[model samples]
Target: MSAPPYHPVVPANPADADAIVACWWTLMAVHGPIDGRMYETVPDAQRVYREHVRRQIDASKGVVLVAPTPDEQGIKGYLLGGLGQRSKVYAVREVGMIFDVAVHPDHRRQGVGEALVQAALRRFRLRGLSDVQVTWSPENRLAHGFWQKMGFAPLLIEAYRKL
Candidate 1:
């Protein structure tokens, strides 16, 4: 049989920070064009994303997962999702939110993304969270199809404009 879509995903440790941050940079690069391209070139972009990952790892209300190469040579993918606030417009006090999910460009269509999301869903379910939400730009056709395939419904539309 062909090799599995990815290696076993596990809880990220302090030692995995560098690799994880690198993957975060890759993630930002991939979405930079689709989301907001200008900020992608900012010098401090990596720093900000690094701090964001660190906080997610430390949060008791969230989980950060990684899929490393079987030989541990490098990370193949990473996922970041956790408990987050709901605006006053929503009835729920909090919700399980998947803030980031990305697989290495070379590893796409290999089940890495789906597996990571499944793991995130299990984590949220274990915490008694019934509703899990994933946000993506409508302009991102890949995200539109993937999130929908993952059972995400479009409930919010956030628009932005430059003056």
Candidate 2:
């Protein structure tokens, strides 16, 4: 049989919450071990997404792109990003900030993440944003490697100390 056909990128709708959540959980499972935190309970993740991300998407300043199965039965990966004014040393202007990009374990190494990033970049260009940035935990070396391979260089580093 021929290899399964995959749609690398597709616009996400509010109805995509379930699929998006699934992808999010998968990512958390992968990274949580290094951070020493338990994976977020499903309800907690859902609440946060609904309260924050869903509203941003509805407001048109945010987007969630998904790579779904060929028949669109379920999503295998997703990228969430938003358009906003970012304060930079030079000036403040619209920029695209990618909050999350995740691909299911089975779909890893299949170019899904790259496709989603490209799609988000295209959307940012259409919105006239000047730049795009993604932030990930310092422990996530895999993500750092991926971003580097995508031609992104670290522009800033942040540190914090608790009193």
Candidate maximizing TM-score = 1
The Cα RMSD in angstroms, rounded to one decimal, for candidate 2 relative to the true structure is 3.5
Clashing pairs in 2: none
RMSD of each: 2.5, 3.5
lDDT of each: 0.80, 0.79
TM-score of each: 0.86, 0.85
Residue 26 alpha-carbon offset, candidate 2, angstroms: 1.4
User: After TM-score superposition, what is the CA distance of residue 70 in candidate 1 from its true location, in Å?
Assistant: 0.6
Off by over 4 Å in 1: 1-6, 35-41, 87-91
The worst-scoring run of ten residues by lDDT in candidate 2 lies at 34-43
Residue-by-residue lDDT tens digits, candidate 1, 1-163: 8865545888877677778878777777767787574434677866777777888788898689988888887878888888987788887767788888888887788888888888888888888778887788777788899999899999878777777
